[model samples]
Target: MLDKHQAVQSHQKKSSRQKLAKVLLATLPMLTVLGATAGLSSCGFQLRGYDTPMLFDIAKTAVIIEDNRTAFPLKLPLTRRLEALGLDVIDNMTLADIANNSNNVGADPIAAITVNNIRFKRYELVGVLTEIRLVLSADVSYQTIENGKPVTLSNPIQVERSYQYNEASVSTDDQQGNQIRDWLYDTLARRITDQYVAISLPKVAPASANKSSQTLKSPEKTTVIVPSS
Candidate 1:
């Protein structure tokens, strides 16, 4: 009787594992779907049907500097970013080419833009010797060709960053300052790109108008059900 009881206990444990396995198998597909949905949502994935307008519709573009003296740090990164965005950045174009409108090649038009008046300012914090605010400002102008006439759109972009001063460690503070400067350069470059793109893109319709149109097109439907005895 004891041996039989032990055998029954072993069988019960085996059965319990089999039941758990079946349950897991039944819900595995649902768990997988939920996980995939969560991952996609977290990464901000969206369907790709829209065309984002850009400053230079043409494949090639020339970035000219009206005042090259103070824009050295910004020029290289800006050019690289433009190239990364599928623009063929022609750095070899001279100022004369840009001025004469000769940068525009036949059939393949070249968009020319100028960046100037780059300036940097630092302000010390009141009553605090260990902190400073840094400001970077620059002027951007895009030359647009309309009816064989050149039109320019100019805008100013500025970015500010604050850094805490460490009086104890001069080396560390200097290193941090350099890092901040590089960060400022990158931020300014990205802002300049974003401003241009925003200006160039077509204006989108308001959400309320879109909702009204959608409501008019497809009115909501309702269904009613009755219980029978």
Candidate 2:
């Protein structure tokens, strides 16, 4: 009786093994079909598209900060953004510096952006423990030579933000305000970048409707027109 029971138990174990093997064999084709996708997911693959725009790839750009105290810090972030587009960030200090950078890269600057005339305004709020509104405006322009003509381009950007504040949390409110200011400055920089990437090379140096956003070329004495589009 004991030998018969042992034989029966061994048979059951073998059957279980055979079932698992059959299941694996049945799914082998499906697993093979998903092997590549599974490998990508296991390796943490992400499908982010190209970082630089087609027109701005490997182009040289310069960010020139004017004497506006409020806008001085805007140059750094704008330069960083431009460099992220695969542009070579070169200093535009003097002719010698420009020549050195150009010689090293064997290319002239595709565009030169000048930022100035920054304005900041704070409206008086009726309640101190309520919301405060801040406005930031900047004048940005890029000068580029196209078809042997000096062309200057400008775009208008102004960032406004409001946040709730409490007098009890003075430190927190102050910190929040600083962060908001930084964000505003970054927004202004990003707008200039968008304008450059979106607009094609200007054919006749057309300015915008707002004169404050117009950039005039100093390298040549020529006429500049306006274009809203």
Candidate 3:
């Protein structure tokens, strides 16, 4: 009886140790996974090519207008609208201001810019058993940043958008075409403006220590535009 009791006690101790070991082995992988997830969350990674504001945040700004490939001209429309959105509005800001191919020559810092879209569409009627209709289209490529270097937030340069006109809705073909073009122009302008301002946050400039930096020289400066009471 004494021998049996001793044997029983030893078996129970062995069983308990084994159970503990099993539990530890099961929990170790889960703990490791949790720790890895927490580490990534703390890092706060942002997606590549999400549009962030350039103005107010970045000191200098430049806009680049590519040559129009489409038959219809949208340059004037884009320029007027973008200027109203609060860009510096410099005419022919040198390529250096926009982007620098050579790092040594131009001192101008490159500015973040975006090209929204370019599109051309044509409607055609074809004979396939019964008059089949086909629409051929080409869309402008939109991109968030230029050059291989990442923008402040790695905003992408090009994204896809769709614009379509239905001749069935309008009485005149000219009216339909005009409406579609207007819609496309307006949409493209707003998209560029929204993305440009989205990532930028306001920053206050620190006061300069040098007296020369603080002062602006103006010999012929006169102001007389007070509202009359």
In terms of TM-score, which candidate is strongest?
A: 1
lDDT of 2: 0.67
The predicted structure with the larger lDDT, 1 or 2, is 1
Task: Locate the minimum summed-lDDT window of 10 residues in model 1.
Answer: 44-53
| Ordered list by lDDT, greatest first | 1, 2, 3
Superposed Cα RMSD, model 2: 17.7
Candidate 3 wrongly placed segments (more than 4 Å):
1-55, 69-72, 91-97, 101-110, 114-117, 121-173, 202-229
Would you estimate the TM-scores of all the predictions?
Answer: 0.61, 0.55, 0.38
For model 2, how does the per-residue alpha-carbon lDDT over 1-229 read when each residue is reduced to its tens digit?
9999999999999999999999999999999857744543334222234222244432566667775568777878888766655566665664345435545654555556767688888865757676779899877776665654557777767889998777676465477788989988898888887786555332322224233334343345679898889
Write model 3 residue lDDT over 9-44, tens digit each, in one string. 999999999999999999999999777545433442
Winner by lDDT: 1
- In what order do the candidates fall by TM-score, top score first? 1, 2, 3
lDDT by residue (5-33, candidate 1, tens digit) is 99999999999999999999999999997
Instruction: Report lDDT per candidate.
Output: 0.70, 0.67, 0.48
RMSD of each: 11.0, 17.7, 24.6
| Poorest lDDT segment (10 consecutive residues) of candidate 3 | 129-138
